[model samples]
Target: MMRIGLILAGGQARRMGGIDKASAILNGRPLIHHVLERLAPQVDQVLISGRSDYGSGLTVLADRTDGPTGPAAGLHAAAKHLADVPDCGLITVPVDAPFLPLDLVERLCAGPLPAIAHAGGRMQPAFSAWTPVEVAAQLAHRPAGAGLALIQLARDANARTVAFENPGAFRNINSAEDLAAAEADVD
Candidate 1:
């Protein structure tokens, strides 16, 4: 099945002083570049889900709601935007996670159901595969403040977790300290 990569770039980033994490520099390249690189080869196309003000080369799907309410809204928006596409799944990732595994798409698509990365015994919901129609239907009935909970959605959808030995594959850069740690790991 064809897969579309969705980069969730709508977070408030309060910890990063309201800066756009996707545009942050890591190892001399914008973090989003790393995400796109990993996602590009794995999917037919890529879309960045965020506010319209944040112009990016990739297709942008603006969240119709406000705040970091949750990733669910962005996921919902992406699903709705790509509703026309048939037989495609969405591989969603956070823009701040520059170290996402190269095999992320493959591993996610290997399952019969929606799948996520379970690295270091933690379920990384942001890095999972989703079907737009299925996800959008779930979003329509999801309770308020429930949109950000990917784990719950996955469980409800009977999604499976793809365990990986490499914890670095899911490492995310949320603060300057996290960025430092990621940089050190890269070295």
Candidate 2:
């Protein structure tokens, strides 16, 4: 099966003072660079879901629907955009998550249905692999802000959770402090 990486970069970044968390510097490189490096080779294509002006040379997709309805909107937009691809599954990752496992795509695709990472006793929904068909179906039927968390969407689609021992593998740089801590951990 073919897999495509969807890097979610549509957040308002209110917690980080309205800055683009994906462009934030970590170890002298943008956080998105780390995510791209880890995911690019594993997937057939990597698309950034959000603003088109973040950078060039990347397939940037703007959300068709308006307003911030959380990551769900971004996922729906990406699924819709890539709906034509045959046998394509989306491996979603937040742009702020720079320490994603290198084998994330492989591990998520090892199962038949969508699979998300289980770390620190929490399901990291953003780091999930979902078939475009399944996601598109949900997008069509689900109501807006119906408390449909990404995990719920995965479960309704009969998705499974892939457990990873290292919680650090899912650390997200949401704030300046989080970025510093992630850098320190890498050091």
Candidate 3:
């Protein structure tokens, strides 16, 4: 399947002290670098959903609607990007999670048409995939504020829930402690 990947970085970053999570340092490199390095090879193209340029040389998308929601904003923008790519799929990963699986897109694409990462007995909704056409059609009905709307959309599409063996891969760096822990994971 044709794949389009989006790094959802348009967060308010309240938990991380209002700093851009993608800019957060990990192992002396920006978290965006780590994420892009792992995710780029898994998809045909990569777009960053952020207010400012991530300085990673990838296209950046911002919330177009008047009242910006949260993750949904990025979701909308990414889905809209599908207008140019016919019959393609969109895979979204949060910018805060630098340790995403190298096979994330591969594993997600192996499941259902619209799928999500289920680890640690919880649904990692942000780490998901969707059919751009279907999501764009029903996206209007979904509240912009519903960050987990993709999970709901996945279920609505009868998506296959893929269980990841490595739960640590889904860890999100939401705080300084989380960043420190991720750094330690490397050394």
Best by lDDT: 2
Clashing residue pairs for model 1: none
Question: After aligning candidate 1 to the native by TM-score, how far in Å is the CA of 10 from where it should be?
Answer: 0.6
Candidate 1 per-residue C-alpha lDDT over 154-182 given as tens digits, one digit per residue, 9 for 90 to 100: 88887888898898888889987787677
lDDT of 1: 0.80
Colliding pairs, model 2: none
Residue pairs with backbone atoms closer than 3 Å in model 3 (clashes): none
Worst 10 residues of 2 by lDDT: 63-72
Predicted structure 3: lDDT: 0.81
Query: Model 3, residue 7: what's the lDDT?
Result: 92
Q: What TM-score number comes out for model 2?
A: 0.92
TM-score of candidate 1 versus the correct structure, residues matched by position: 0.90
The sequence of per-residue lDDT tens digits that candidate 3 reaches over residues 24-131 is 899998888888888999999988888766777788888876322677678788878777778787899988888899999998998556788899989998998887
How would you order the candidates by lDDT, starting with the best? Answer: 2, 3, 1
Q: Give the alpha-carbon lDDT of every model.
A: 0.80, 0.82, 0.81
